[model samples]
Each structure stands twice: as structure tokens, then as C-alpha cells.
Target: MGFRHTLRDDKLYFYERRDIMEQRHNYLKKIRQYRREDRPIVYLDETWANSHMAPERLWLDEQGRGGWKRPSGKGQRLIILHAGSETGWTPNADLVFRSKKNSTDYHDEMNSEHFLEWFQKLLVNIQPGSVIVLDNAPYHNSVVEKVPTKSSRKKEMQEWLTRKRIPFSDKDLKKDLFAKIQLSVPNRKLYATNEAAKACGHIVLRSPVAHCELNPIELVWADVKRYLKVHNKTFKLADLEQLVPDAFQSVTPEMWAKHCQHVQEEEERFWEKDGLQEESVEEYIIELGTEDDDDDIEVRDIEFEGEGEDSDGEQDECEPVMDENDRELLRSDAVSDA
Candidate 1:
């Protein structure tokens, strides 16, 4: 009875966290390298402005507790894509999409094509020697069709290898019996945004997964919500659309500077801490301060619902489905049978 075994708690995703830190270190090195070159770096991200979003309570006084009810309706929301940088917010580089619910019952969303269109604008307007920071969303990291992991290429795969100038051919190259051939090469040019950025004479920097603290835009979002909450009296979609522009415009350049500086400090802190997630972080306060998220407010995926056809505009995975033709090809036997 005295000899009882003790159970220990397991650390979930321990190895995964370490891998993420390793990624952080590598990215930080790249960032520092860019900084030394005097290349401007801008952090980019997308967020949803929901119609049902607003404050839930009031500051309670010793004399009385204050509570209020806000009107509700089926209001639409818009998905806005914005960017911020060290200098300040980029002028003439924000996109807004009317998010409507599609037949799939989800929300119409921003996919790779939409992002790429905006990204083209971003590249054009941004300064030379600039690094556009992004999360590891699939779209941002989209690249040319990677070589398939096969010994020989289909007509298309063969063409890709030739175009990429990868030296591997059943004719030009020989393989040992024990060894295998690989048409697919790792570390090849990433597709979509990465490839596009490089082609446009800009750099694409990606934040590590699970490291939200590294993006100043996250803090900017909190401020935007606080602004919306303060002015959101009637939860109407039309008003929300109008308020969104106001909310974003309300973000002063000083706030952007503070948030960006805070992100750099967080990067340094993360490095000093050797990748361990901090129990506490000194938060960057907005000019309007912050608001408490209502406990009843349901947190959904980033894309807000509107009235439209169902789509895979999921920002969570941020996967880009290049174009309609590409999508069809992937679905067809051309690539699948291969």
C-alpha cells in the first residue's frame, strides 16, 4: 500500500516547440542580415472585422454594477488585409473584401490569388531593398509546382525540371541500384508569394508558427477592435464597413512605431530565453488602451461570414489555390493520376 507509483505530466508538442524555436533563430538571422543591408522590413497580416463585435460590459463602481445591452442583427463583415512596417503603415496598400456566407456554410474569403493581387500592389509601392514579413500561411509561401517525388517526369514534370535547370535526367544522370532518383527537390524556389517576391526584387520573410508575439500587427488588431467596440452602438453591417475604415485610419503612426518596436524587443527576448515560451510579456499599450473580450463572444476562424458562394478562402491555413485552371488541373486526372 505504501509503494504507490507516481504519474507524471507529459509535455505536449515539446519537440515541435523546439523545432519552431530553431525556425525562429534562422529567421532572425535572415532579418539581421537584411537589417545590415539597410533593407526595410514590413510585417503583413490579415484580420476579420465582424459585425457582432463590440464591448460587453462597463467599469463597475463601488456604488453600482453597470451593464448594457447592444442591439443585434444579421450584419455583414468585411475581411481586411493590412500591413505595417518600421517606418509606419504603408500608404495605398490595404484591401477590403466583402465576406459573405457561401453555400458551404462558411465564409467567402481571401485566397492566394487575392493576396497575390494585393501583394503586387505592395511590391510596387514599397521601397527598394524591402522585406515583406508574413506568417507561414500557405499562400505567402506558395511556389512553383514542386517537382514530383518520382524517378521520371511526366511531360509536365520534365518540362519543370528543364525550366528550373535542375540537373537530373534518366539520360544525363545515372543512379546506383541501391540509390533512388528524385525529381522533387527540397529547398527549391517556394511558389506563389515567395517566388513572386523574389522575382519583383523584394524579399519575403515569414514568422514562425505559434509565435504571435513576433508580429506587431497582432497588437494593432487589438487596438482596432477596441476602437470598434467603443463606437459600435448598433451592430449593423453597413455601419461596420464605414467604421472599419475609420478604425484603421484612427491608428496613429506613433502606435505603429510602438508596436513594431515591441515586436523587435520580443524577438530579442525570445532569443535570450532560448525559445521557451514566456509566462509573461510586457504588452504594447494602444493609445485607446485595450478592452476585455466578452466571454460569450465566439471566436471563429479569421475569415468573417458574408453572403457569397462557398470558398476555400481560409486564412488559418492560408493555402493558396493558384488559379481556377490550376485548381481544375489538380482535381482532374492530369496531376492526380500521376
Candidate 2:
């Protein structure tokens, strides 16, 4: 009776997986540690903007016949990539280019090579010894050398082992070779981005899979898109291109600080929640049986309400509140661009 009808949204199947949980906990902990150490934190992500991106609703006359006609379809798109910290956007780090294909997902427009080039520019502009917080995008996790998985062919796995110089008998079966490889490389695989960041005296902290809310840059993207939606008059590609810079300029240092603060609050909430969950699990195990009494006791399942939603039972809108100064800044930038 308390439930209300709402639209259903797809969620990642592994949102509550044990490995994901551990990864999230580690990420939150590391972020806290980095903050305590006074290390600069930069959030990076990619987003796309359609040429015809405009507000879905508009005012009409009393007869509801005065609204302008909307564009027929989403026209060309622009893929944007950048990194920023609470202080402000990294200088010379923004990358905006027309997308070649009209792919549904923005990631399809980005690949390891493109990302690496942008990342190099970001590395040069960001503060030294900064902690770069990145989402688990495929491009962000390009491995230096891909480790063999069960899906890999037997010969492929064997060749990888041979390359790694891990001893393996010629007669070993696929499973045996795989087991040996696992034993030899039990740690998390190395990523080229991580190595590159480390080389530049920066650290890369990857947000857990499907945790876009953890990256403040996502909030920045929302602000940029909102600006576009509110001011997109023509819905023309040329006009949209001109508007993009002003949209980004609307995001001020104060706004970036606010977004970063919100992210920190979310991180803290997660840290506390993880602690409580661990305590609950420990309490459950103790109540069930002692460690010595290993009689295959089945633990009671625990469920969290609104597992993926924020504290208010809704996804974080992070609606930007622009003051006069912010508006003036955007106007000035637009005028200058013109």
C-alpha cells in the first residue's frame, strides 16, 4: 500500500557482488586517505552532447499553440573529455571533437589511443602528485598486457604463459596452464593508464563499476547539459558548437567545489555504511556459530532498502544553482567567443 508507481530503470547485475563491494570499500578508503594527506584530487570522465539537445518542455499560449517545433531527430554529436579538481578545470585538458558515428553509447566514440592522448595532456596540467579519480570505463582500464581468461584458447593461454616466462609443462592441459598463470599473477592486473599516471607522479583511483555518482565530473556534465538544454535555440550543429564553450564556462570554481564536497559526503556515507555492513555480518556469524563449529551453517541474508538510490530515495540530480556572478561570467564568455 505504501508503494507508488514509478518508471523502472535497468541496474547493473553486479552492483551488489562481493568483489564490487570490496572494490567500492577500497576506493572510498583510498579517497579518504588521499584527502587526509592533502593530495589534490582530479575527477575525469567523458560525455556526449547531441546537436538538438533542448529542453523537453516549453511554455505555450493559453490555446497551447505557440510553442516552437522541435528538431526532427538528434543531429550530430560532440564527445567531450576533461579532468578537473575542486580548484577548477585543468588548463589545456579539455577535448571536444565531433563524433564520427551516431552511437548510442558515448564510450563507443572513445578508445584507448584517444584516451591516452587526452590523459597525457591532463597529466601535464593537473597538480603534481594528484589523485586522479576515474570511472571504470573500458578505455581507462587498458591493460599493459592482457591476462588470459578461461575464454582464451588453450594455445593462446600457453603462449601468454611462455611470454611471461612462467614455467609450464608442454603436456599441461588448458586448465592446468590457467591455474599456473593465476598462481603466478594473483594480484590485480596492471593498467597502462595507472602506470602512466604513476610515471607523472600522480595516482589513479578507479571508481567501482557502475558508480558514476562517485565522480564529481559527472555532476559537471549535468550542469553543462542543463545549460545547453536551457539555451539551445536553433538546435543547429554550428550553434551547438558555439554554445558548448559557454555551457562549460557556466561551471565556476565555487560550483566545482560544491560538487566535490557532495562527492565527499557520499564517500563518507559509503564508508560508514560499509562499516555497519561488516559489523552486521560479523554479528550474524557469531550468533550462528563459533569459528570452531564449522558445521556448514547457513548465514541469514540481509537486504538494504533503496540499495542503489541516494539518501533521499532518488538519483542525485545535482542541479546547479547559478548566481548572478556565474550568469555574468557565462555571458561574458559567450560575448568573447562571438
Candidate 3:
């Protein structure tokens, strides 16, 4: 039969696309469903250090808090990793430790190995649930090796053939090991990380791409930075090691609960507007594009390889959308209560 379309008189075919707001709505709806169903869920994300050094700013508590010296200028960057659950903030870690591998500079970046090490530590301790809220970042994914197939080297192919219980015996299998092995098609099966997640009891809920508002941890970062920007007087890397964790601790459990509720409100807005924000409508006029260069909070994505690929040769590549954060404007009310 030839290709067909709109055959029934009662219906017509139309291609439709969900706008960004609608996409956000869907993301929130799904996560809420997980919560509604009482699924174990934790929001995981990372935020890097920003360039908000004070030529100097610090707070001295009337309660006799010690003072910090102001720096003349800037210093090295840092990265922070942590997770948030409905209960509260998870213990946080900063990437300012001297690199075990390089030993020259601080651990300023995250990779598959770094993420995996963190996951191994996290997975065993997680609540008995089946979801991990990871963004579409490459570092969050890693590949697993596939079992060798029949088309193997003499030794490997024979070993695989024996294990697969193919018709060939010791002698015939030996002959086919190095000889030309043929079949109707190539058995191109590569590994992907979802399998490992399945084994670990997670259904990995990935956040929508380019949507930071959907991640509650985004709110956490905003609060944390508000603290760091105020307390960063010494502008010393050693001082940051102390300041970063303090900021992470500043976010109360109530704040995380508020973030979850705020996301629900956003979802409700989308649902009521049918995902049509005024400016999001196709015919709406817009101003010329300009970025808020002074914005301190920046989210970046890095790529990681997935399980196996098809028989066809292809490789995963990184996205060049780097968030090279520049200097940040100090908060208007920096020196508040220490």
C-alpha cells in the first residue's frame, strides 16, 4: 500500500509544536505526578563560582565576629556540587581541592568520572525510590561496554559463540572464530546508561533543555549566591572554601519547600494560559536581542558518552554553549547581618 494521510472524514492531520512555556508546564506536571505518586525524587545540579570579588566587602557582627581584609583584585574560580530533596539541602562539596590528578590547580571542573564517583557515593544512600532529576548534561551520563557479539576475533568470537549456544561446536566454532562470519545484518548494539539506571531503580527524569526555572536547585543557587556575594570580603581562595559551604547551609528546608511550591505555581500559570504567555505567542512583537551581561548566575552543560551506539560509526560531541562568566556586580545590600 502507498503512504496515507487524513483518511477518515472525521479528522485531519496537523503538525503541532509545544512552545517553551508549555514544555516547562509539562516538566513540572510530570515531576508533580512523581511526587503525587510518592516516588522518591531528588533534584541534583551544579553551579560554578562567579566573578563577584570585592575590591572588598565584609560584614562585622556587633556580636564580635572577626573581620576579613579586602583584596586588591580577583582570583581563581570555583565550582560547587550538591543535591536537594524535599527534606532539605544535601551536604555540599566545593571543587577547590587541589586536583589529585594535576596537583597544580584546584578541581575547577566536573567530568563523567567525577560525576560517577559522586553517584556511587549517592546511589547507595538514596531513599528507596526510582527517580533522579538530572539535567541534559553530558557529565551526568556514561557508557557501559556491550557484550561481544558473534562477529568477534578468533578467540573472542569463539568465546561469544560458545556462550550464546550457537549451533557451532568446539571444532566448528573454532573455525568460525577467525573465518568470515556472516548473517542477514550487522548486530549493532551499544550500551547506554539508562540500562544501569534501570538496574539501580531510577527512571532518570531529565529537565527540559534551556529551562533553569524548572529546576528547584536553581532557586537554591540564587539564595546561596546572595550569601556568597555579601560575605566575599577577603576574596581569597581559602576564604571561599569556608564561604561556599556556609552559603549552602544558609538555605533552609523551608526555602526548598517554597521552591517546589513555586514551580507548582508556574505550572498552574501555564496550564491556565494554555501555555501561551503573552510574549511567547507567535505574532507577538519583540525587542532586539540583548543578554543581561551582569547576571551572576550561569548554568552550563557538558557532554558525556552514552552506552553503545548502532553498528554505524558515530560519536557523541560536546555542545559549544560555554557559560564563560565574567565579573558580577555586588549586591546592593552586601554588608547585612553577619
Tell me, by TM-score, which candidate is best.
2
Go through the candidates in order and give each one's C-alpha lDDT.
Answer: 0.59, 0.69, 0.51
Show the lowest summed lDDT stretch of 10 residues, model 3.
283-292
Ranking by lDDT: 2, 1, 3
The parts of candidate 3 lying over 4 Å away from their true place are: 1-29, 50-74, 91-108, 146-193, 274-338
What TM value does model 2 have? Answer: 0.73
The residue-level lDDT of candidate 2 at 265 comes to 86
Q: Tell me the TM-score of each prediction against the true structure.
A: 0.65, 0.73, 0.55
lDDT of 1 by residue, 4-36 (tens): 555321112221344545566666667766777
* Superposed Cα RMSD, model 2: 14.3
Candidate with the greatest lDDT versus the true structure? 2
Candidate 3's TM-score: 0.55
**Which is the better candidate, 1 or 2, if ranked by lDDT?**
2
Estimate, for each residue in 1-338, the C-alpha lDDT of model 3 and write its tens digit: 99565432210100022333334455656666777779877777765443334323346789858665544333455666778776786544233342233321122256666776776556655676657776655545444432333334466655555565655555665345434333421342222334455667765666654445556777787688678767776566677667877887799999998997786676566556564322322211111111211111123222222111211111111111212321111122223411
Minimum summed lDDT over a 10-residue window in model 1 is located at: 283-292
